[model samples]
Target: MTFSIVARSGQALGIAVASKFLAVGAVVPAAEAGAGAVATQAAANLRYLPQGLALLRTGVPPADVVAGLVAADRERAHRQVGIVGPEGPGATYTGEECLDWAGGRAGDGYAIQGNILTGPEVVEAMESAWLSSPQEELDRRLLAVLAAGDAAGGDRRGRQSAALYVVSPGAGYGGGSDVACDLRVDDHPDPVGELRRLRDVHELLFGTPDPGTLLDLSGELKEEVQSLVAERGYASLDMWVGVENLENRLVSGKIDPVVLARLRDAAPDGK
Candidate 1:
């Protein structure tokens, strides 16, 4: 019915999940910055999300959290879960009653699990992608793994929805929240691909530019930037930066080379 990966990358924690069920994101994934991530599905015990994060915040190891949750549940045999914390490796569990082809794999900083998947290859491909994908952002890595699983014959029942949820301190809009990335394909025939498309849009709209990569906006370059912004219907260069949420990297009224490049890409005549 589903395939998922929960992982910890640097200061971020995230979960990526795909399912044959609609709105799987609303029920299967949860994470807290600097704490951990969890995916509870296959007769998911929603309590595992909050309780598991609470235990993780209190310094409980991921394995201990999984054990405690299963111990307390009378219907444990019907549940499947994956957990990864800010420190140490990850943990996962697939109950006996889950549909055929159900299983899981866990490794340093990540866990991959599935029920009603084609076979172990689904999780295996996810693990390979998570360990090998070159995406620096945790959410992108998670999405890569989800895409890998889908390519490896993901949910035996086919796709309906997919989601990516990631958190890091001060990573959200305006740097005021921990939700670095949260996107969902509530229903789609190619939900993982839809998720990838949305992730790209999210990056363009919300991603912060690297200070090391910024190109100075001055003299003729500044004039070019102003022209570009105005051509895009902005009243001023500053207005363009504000609308694109690039203020964090475009302060001092200087434009980022990436921003200039994006503006050029959006040129009405494709010049």
Candidate 2:
């Protein structure tokens, strides 16, 4: 019913999943910054998500954790799972009684699994995309992996939902939480494309500013920006940024060009 990839990149743990089922995000993906990621589908034992991370937190290897989980379940023969822990190696498990075309692959930093898929090519495409993807942020990379599978004819039942979840130390808004990027398309004719659009907007609003693009607000440029800010009804430039939730685009008295353009676009008149 679902296809998923659980992977580790640098210090990030992430999962990208899509299914014929609805709201897959609410149930399929889970990860902790320094612990691990888990995807439980096909007769999914929801407890495996939390329990898997707990085991990884305690230094249990992914293979051993999967072994323990399956061994303890009466429905072991029908479950499908993937795990990537803080330690030794990643692992994937497809139960003996899972639906046709069910299987998995695990090695190095990723585990890919799918059940009731159009064909084995779905998993193959995901694995290839993950292995060959550019050195970009984990969020983007995982989405590429998901899209690859989706293009390969994803779940034979059809697409309805998709999600991408990633976690890393101090990666959330204002460095407040471990959750990095969490986007979902609960039900859509093109869930993967919708997921990609949400990610693009997320990057615009919350992505880290590029250090090389930071510009000092000074002299004539500063005065012009001040005028734009005042034109928008804010007493100061910083106030304008605060009012519009653009604080993440401002840093140490400097601004990214994209943020400046955004302000210019919103001022009372053209720049």
Best by lDDT: 2
lDDT of 1 by residue, 1-271 (tens): 9999999988999999999999999999999998899999999999999999999999899999999999999999999999999999899999999997999999889989999999999999999998896557788788889989999999998889999999999989888999999898999999999999999888876776777777777889888877877778877777776766656556565556667877778754323
lDDT of 1 at 61: 94
TM-score for each model: 0.92, 0.94
As a TM-score, model 2 comes out at 0.94
User: What residue pairs clash in candidate 1, if any at all?
Assistant: none
Clashing pairs in 2: none
lDDT of each: 0.89, 0.90
Q: What TM value does model 1 have?
A: 0.92
